[model samples]
Target: MKNLKGKVALVTGATRGIGKGIAIGLGEAGATVYITGRTLEPSDENISGTLLETQQAVIDAGGVCIPVQVDHSDDEQVRLLFERIETEQKGQLDILVNNVFSGVKEIGNAFGQPFWKHDPSLWDAINNVGLRSHYIASVYAARLMNKRQQGLICTISSWGGLSYIFGAAYGVGKAACDRLASDMAVELKPDNITSVSLWPGIVGTEEMFRFSEKWKTEDEKEPQNSTMRDYYNWETPLFTGRVIAALADQQNTMNLTGKVQIIAELAQRYNIVDENGNRPVSLRSLRFIVPSAIPALKKYPWLIPDLKIPWFVLQWTMLQSPKI
Candidate 1:
């Protein structure tokens, strides 16, 4: 725990998965968290989690939680969300976590298919609510933060931005997300607001389990494929959230602005472990990723110490990435 007693945070898409976990994690650090999502209560659909549930979980984690229902695709609703927060928190918005993305189902449907095979609308499906929405939310948050001349805006991105993890639409959206943070930081830095993209290692979230199964099925079809789709050694959603909480509470937040921060590395920096007392694997840690991908080598993972790939080497993904 980082000290965040009087901070006010807004985490969008907090009904489930990462958004929910981040809200709870911020709550755990003693911030007054406001969670926004479409589902307010239990629904008839198979998808689990609701704002009511996330609110209770956040409260249980030892912070105040307020739930708001909003359809992010609507600009009016998004505007109202910030207005309400300003009214409730009295012009004080300390942190913003943009975690809303409705493209999972679209990606699931188009998994492994080439870019040409996908409909042009695929871009809208992913970026409209994800990449574009993040910018909108940042606009509102920045306004509040600007008034105070201080704030933190964290965009949950992925390694997919550097390498091809999912598909074209996803890769493009994620890459743009990183760029958004980098560019935003350039403008916000003078005001003392921190902005950056965060890349979490394979997060062990409920939806991720379902998403990885898509990979398993695809990997089965191509036994020779080099890509790995296992989540056995991935980080918990809360761990990623915890990293963001730590990011917000940092004394010199400007030092980390304008770049993509890896959640795994931040975990080590902050000495954070999941609630189960386990440290999640890092992509560069050959020991962890290698064993997680090839279960046969699982037992040997602990033998190797934690080491990260150099930034220059990790950035060279064009040749290494599959040319599909």
Candidate 2:
């Protein structure tokens, strides 16, 4: 990784999971990272990890860390956080990772529960902290980046946006994240700033490992349980972080703006392996017999009409049906 000794980065929700990993990655590359989350102290039990812990971890990795307590759902707090960054860092902001997310806590182990059955507040829980918070952070980040005429804004999204993974709210929020990055890139392009949505395949975060263990014990009788068990090729949160760090160091980051990149594929390109020294399988490679086959079919005009009906019908049904 290129030295980021003087670069400044802010990673929202850096208390745990992907956000924590990314903050650490940036820090490891010598960036002065501002780690933000609601959990300020190590004793805070509201979440699994605390900002102080993540800050310490980053410091241990030979990087500077400034932990900040901010409720990302609060717009004023976010604005004030950026204002402080501007004041402290002399208006230089190099990178922003919009990774705060909620609402999955409400879903719990009921992965396939009908959307309507879920509490209506579930939508607000997701959009408020996940989607809207990202936009709010970006608004402030854009202002800071525009001053320097350079920066990278990465939204940690997933393949869930492209295909149904969990439920309606989660999928919609992720889809919006991708669209946000694409649209933001269009506006930021003139200033040489890049915005991208990253899809990290089945990351084995601490929460996910706990969920996997629970699924194995409780849902062993189900066929989907076997599939879940077989999902061992999970990437570490740091894998995506490493990719982002590498991308930030690239000379031609503008070339990748407005794109949705698959971490697994990028890992192959960047020669990045998980902490366990394993390469995670890309979903496209695993689920499709020939990953490029569907796109190849687009070349044939005769195949278009045949594909359109089933595709349209499936989409219509997905829209009408209650996603659990």
Q: What is the lDDT of candidate 1?
A: 0.85
Question: Can you tell me which runs of candidate 2 are displaced by over 4 Å?
Answer: 44-46, 217-224, 287-324
Give the per-residue lDDT digits (tens) of candidate 1, residues 1-324. Answer: 538999999999999889988998999999999998888999779568899999999888888999999989999999999999999889999999989988878887887788789889999998988999999999999999999999999998987787776788899899999999999999999999999999888777787778766566654534213233544566778998888888887888788999989888888898888878888767777766466556667656777677877777767744475432
Question: Could you tell me every candidate's TM-score relative to the true structure?
Answer: 0.93, 0.85
| Top candidate when judged by lDDT against the true structure | 1
Across 1-324, the per-residue lDDT of candidate 2 in tens digits comes to: 437888999999988899888888888888999989998986635558899999988988888999989998788999999999999999999999999987657656446577887678888877789889999999999999998899999998986676676678888889999999999999999999999999997777877876676667754555434435655446788887777777777777887899888787777777777767866656555232122223333234243321222345545655674321
User: Model 1: runs farther than 4 Å from truth?
Assistant: 220-230, 292-294
Model 2 poorest 10 in a row by lDDT: 286-295
What's the alpha carbon RMSD for model 1?
Answer: 2.3
Q: What is the C-alpha RMSD of each candidate to the true structure, in Å?
A: 2.3, 6.7
Model 2, CA-based lDDT:
0.79
